[model samples]
Target: MSDMYKAPQAELTNGEEHGDFGSVEKGIAGDYSFSISETVSEGWRLSKGKKRTVWLGILLYVIALIAITVVAGFITGVFTAEGDASFTQELIYNLITTIIGFPLAAGMTMIGIKIARGEDTSGTEVLAYFDKIVPLVIVNFLMAIFIFIGLLLLVLPGIYLMVAYLFAIPLVVDQNLGPWQALEASRKAVTKRWFSFLGFLILLLLIGLAGFLAVLIGMIWALPLLFIAIGVAYRKVFGSPHRA
Candidate 1:
């Protein structure tokens, strides 16, 4: 496999270089990830089998996501509280720039390390990825611009771009690709199983609605398990991790 598609930890074992292109169904994500797989699983054939690691990851991530969502809202509120130039105004600006402001590189790099090491990963892993790689964070911010422009044209394309590059951060960290290349590699991986990917995308949205109606717990519990299933399914359906 090209280094562009291989993990950083890839080594030529006695002159044979094979970098973790495991059975798609079995998961080649050992290198690292920042996924919307939960969102993706709503329609895909992926299965979220219950496991200690997956469950624990889900529980912790759900709590963290909820906390972050709440905190971001609070921050926005605080920004808005202080009149015209309040934090809200500043927040709107920051949110727009989060791709650039936060540690996009740090996230990818850390995930790379974890995946290479085949370690259990969590939200903190993402933060660590950001902490380690700083420059990519700005590029991520710029990529957001392209996404916004794509969205401005219409919603479908925006969603397409979103799904296409959902795994870009992971690809970049593990493979050392530049932003556009990462986007291309990520898009290729996802599109390799277009039907399956699309199917899961639709399924997850429906599940999300269900989760909404059932209250936040629906999202909390449904999301992780569903995602785990999708990730697993991606392997089975595509038979090749990189293709989809």
Candidate 2:
């Protein structure tokens, strides 16, 4: 990693950068304050001078995405290639893919956390979360089920939960929390700043769209920015991990 990507070891001593959340602000949901602008700005600070490293991370991510898509497509092709596949078959295929794809999702989060922490990241880091596979898969599965149920009730609640639990994966991988614990922690951390999180998400989405529009190659770079931004938000919300 270049100096741009290297965070000084001294800064790592402070486990929680946001300080005690409840001490800062209170909300109807609970206490905990977050600044969407500050979080995004911190993300930019982490990413600003690290263009080369960020692009490398993105390239690895894109390659991984392509690989996963190809494998999923191949599996689907096997069952549906016969042309007699039914809705049930497709549903089963989707579930299978979701289960198998959990590791990649976790890997992506791990990469994001690493980048945010200024740790060295390489293509191999994409699969670093595989060792903690069970909890990662369980956490993701539970989050999806709850979010879907919430969506069934109303659009707003579902969207709320989506942002509420956005940090579950990072919590799981970074904090070593259980599935339920991670989900609940993520919910609590984001509860006070849900709207801000929404706005942040929208900003990232627009950035991603811009990447797509830029000759389709810009996503290779934009993807890292998105991940780093998320990392920044995660840090701002939950604070950094305790480094011994």
Candidate 3:
């Protein structure tokens, strides 16, 4: 089995080698940190020569998304007579998609982590996290509610939570932590360097935007690069488990 599939034994500390690729260097104040440039550069490097696999995985995910949307729409349509859906129908549709999307998103994160660990992947691994659907769904739902409430209070709090909780799902999946525990762990870890993490997210957003503007084909590369970069950041902050 690939090291990616094996359960990690313990969290890696500063200066530990992630795999055969490289080691996580120590940052200021003895806290874990990652360079935005280095992280993205590593993402680009790993993404290189793996376009087909990455694209295939994206295609599968997109198809699954479309399938769910169609199914949900069809189900919603059964309740409405007009072409437009009722508010309740729309709510139902969103609920369905959101519930299903959590695990899929986690799967993508898993694939990114796998790639960051220098393992080969087929992209189809996006379907692998359904086994942990309950916590995955709960954590995401709670995250959305908190972010929504924070945004309602003021834009800054919402944005803060947005960047802070970025690793909640990954922690849940990788460390097998419960929903609230994952949220707290992610929030606390990210709070240490919240601004830096926000900047990293902004840079990634820019990269994703650039890909979208490049005639859309760039997404094939851009999407994988984004996820891989995120995975790299995740490893930097929390460290990886020991591979079997």
> For each candidate, how many residue pairs have backbone atoms clashing (under 3 Å)?
25, 0, 1
RMSD of each: 9.7, 4.2, 5.2
What's each prediction's TM-score?
0.53, 0.77, 0.82
- The lowest-lDDT stretch of 10 consecutive residues in candidate 1 is 11-20
Cα lDDT tens digits, model 2, 1-244, are 5454455573343224545222111222355556767766666666665556655555666777667666765677644467776776677667766665677676776666666665666545666666777897899879889989999997777888998888888777777889998888878767766788889899899989999999989876677778877876665555545632
**Order of candidates by TM-score, top first?**
3, 2, 1
Please identify model 3 stretches exceeding 4 Å from their true place: 1-30, 76-87
Per-model lDDT: 0.47, 0.68, 0.75
Note the residue pairs that clash in candidate 2.
none
| lDDT score at residue 193, model 3, on the 0-100 scale | 82
TM-score: model 3 vs. ground truth: 0.82
Candidate 1 lDDT by residue in tens digits, 1-244: 1123333333213112323233322233323222345324322321222233334444444555556555665556644455556655666655634543245334433332332332345434444444424546644765687789889998777777777665555444544567776666566666665555666667667886787789676765555445444433332322232332
User: Largest TM-score belongs to which candidate?
Assistant: 3
